[model samples]
Target: MRANLKLKFEKPLVLPIHYNHIIQAAILKLLSDENYSRFIHDQGFKYEKRHFKMFTFSRLEGNFLIDKGNKTITYFDGASLQISTIEEEFMKYIINNVLLNEGIKLIGNHIQVEKVELKHMDVEEGGGRITTKSPIVVYSTFEIEGRKKTYYYNPKEKEFEEILRKNLIKKYMAYFGKEPKDKYFKITPIENLKESIVIYKGTVIKGWNGIFEVNGSPEILKLAYDVGLGAKNSQGFGCFEFI
Candidate 1:
């Protein structure tokens, strides 16, 4: 399930250029249930040593101006953000909390929820084209010179596809509590592939945005659509829409 939130503020919405953490915090703040909030925020669904939040969200969508000097973006009118998740409980909490609250305080700015749209998609036997709502991230960490270093992969790299497939399988296991009958999955860029660099908190992260041909098992494909692709999904990466 997906929830698209249309928001309006009395004044222009201004935020730092790297505002992913801020948006994340705002969403977590909406959870009225304390235990549920801590579970998703601190722990999440566990599989092996990994924790899967099973949700992803898009960047704010609207017309905006960038102040290079200030390193901030200001949206003139309003903005919308789409949140996707496979967990029905989490979806219910977000929708209910947002509707019940009079307004949302995002980064010290008061914004009203103008509208909320719910959507769902069916992935057929054959996969379809998908365009990213947020860039997909794939990376590896290694010990170099007695220090840990992170390397981000380009979409064209073979490792990119391999890691993505493996990641999805793990997510499937985490959610379904069983292995998928079919493990087949592949994603290839079709057009307009672009590299994106994002700063979350203070860490530099790399990702890719593009229209891609996603072919895979229907169940796994649907899971990818629901929870996003690649990595760092909860931190606003790998949200896509079927094209």
Candidate 2:
């Protein structure tokens, strides 16, 4: 099972808000469901400068809400509202205005979100049986420091590729606030290159993804190509290279 908290904020405040606070609030609310609901009904929060009256609730996906005045019902995954918090009747006011707009109050706040997950293992007899099955194949390129290396694997390929992609995305998102997309499908091979060097060869394809060290003296980078050729082409094979 996976758990996550989401929040909705009033527009036009600070240029950038660290959505962490909204996540924290949702976590505390979920942990203290009954008590938190009672608190909101009783000692609600108020703001003077900005009359942002916000009420949050939690709901599962695929829920429905009905508007009594309009005699309309709507299904929604999320919702948000704006109102004044000065008076004790703010909730009533919001209901009279926004909720009356054929909107049903969504459970929990809706905005930037964070996830907290829980997992458990299934235990069963004969669950660990092994079979002789062909492994998945993956072709990956990696870079360390300034050196570059490429690998081809059948089974363990995903392990290395995931690690490398995770590190790269983490570093990139930390600085750029977004993740990088795959570039393999977009690459055009540079064939019959005159200036080229063979880095590694004869590597046994084991898993979908794997990491391999470049043979010979390590200079700037090492790369591996999936040489697609018949067993007859082993000696003096027609080579195809990727740039």
Candidate 3:
């Protein structure tokens, strides 16, 4: 299940651009500490490249234009928050309770839930990889090695199809707890893909933002769509939506 949430702020707020971890902390607040750690973090690296987080979210959308000359800033009225999970119970519990005690305090400003739009798509049993309608996938690969290197489509390294397929298989085993029927998948890029970067944790973290059609296991595809794709999903990378 997924929720399109609009957060109304009690007062205007400002913060550094690198606020992914802070948003992650707010998401974990929806669940119990044990569950949060178990599902969102500290998932034993028992597997090769899997982490505990089974969900991903979109960037906060609101006013962000800064006016340095005036020494003033315009704040956004609200922000849209999209949260999803693989399990039904998890989604229901979090939605019903995330706002129970008090609203989420994001970036030192308390935000109230103004609106919510719930969406759900279930993969039928025996469903295969490609569905009747294809979805555009945009994912940000995690930083590897000592430096941040991001790639959307680097033909020099390898075809995007091969890279995405290999990563999806690992994610399938890690998140779904089973090997995927198809070991490989394909990503047909619909648009010109390129590399991008963002300031996270006070460093230049490489990333990719583009769209593609995923050809793989239907169940795994849905899981990727709902939860996220690639590594470091909880830290906000790889969850995609229809373009």
- TM-scores across all candidates? 0.96, 0.16, 0.75
Worst 10 residues of 1 by lDDT: 101-110
Which segments of candidate 1 are over 4 A away from where they belong?
none
lDDT of 3 by residue, 106-191 (tens): 65566788777889866544233331111223334467776765544442244545655666666667666788875645555455
lDDT of 3: 0.60
Candidates sorted by TM-score, descending order? 1, 3, 2
Per-residue lDDT of 120-196 in model 1, one digit per residue for the tens? 87888669889999999999999989999899999888999999999999999988899999999999989999999
Q: State candidate 2's TM-score.
A: 0.16
For candidate 2, the 10 contiguous residues with the lowest summed lDDT are 216-225
Q: Report every candidate's CA lDDT.
A: 0.90, 0.26, 0.60
Check candidate 1 and list the clashing pairs: none
Instruction: Please give the lDDT score at residue 189 for candidate 1.
Output: 88
User: Best-fitting candidate, measured by lDDT?
Assistant: 1
Off by over 4 Å in 3: 33-39, 44-46, 66-75, 123-159, 192-194
Pitting candidate 2 against candidate 3, the one with the higher TM-score is: 3
**Model 3 deviation from the true structure expressed as Cα RMSD, one decimal place:** 5.3
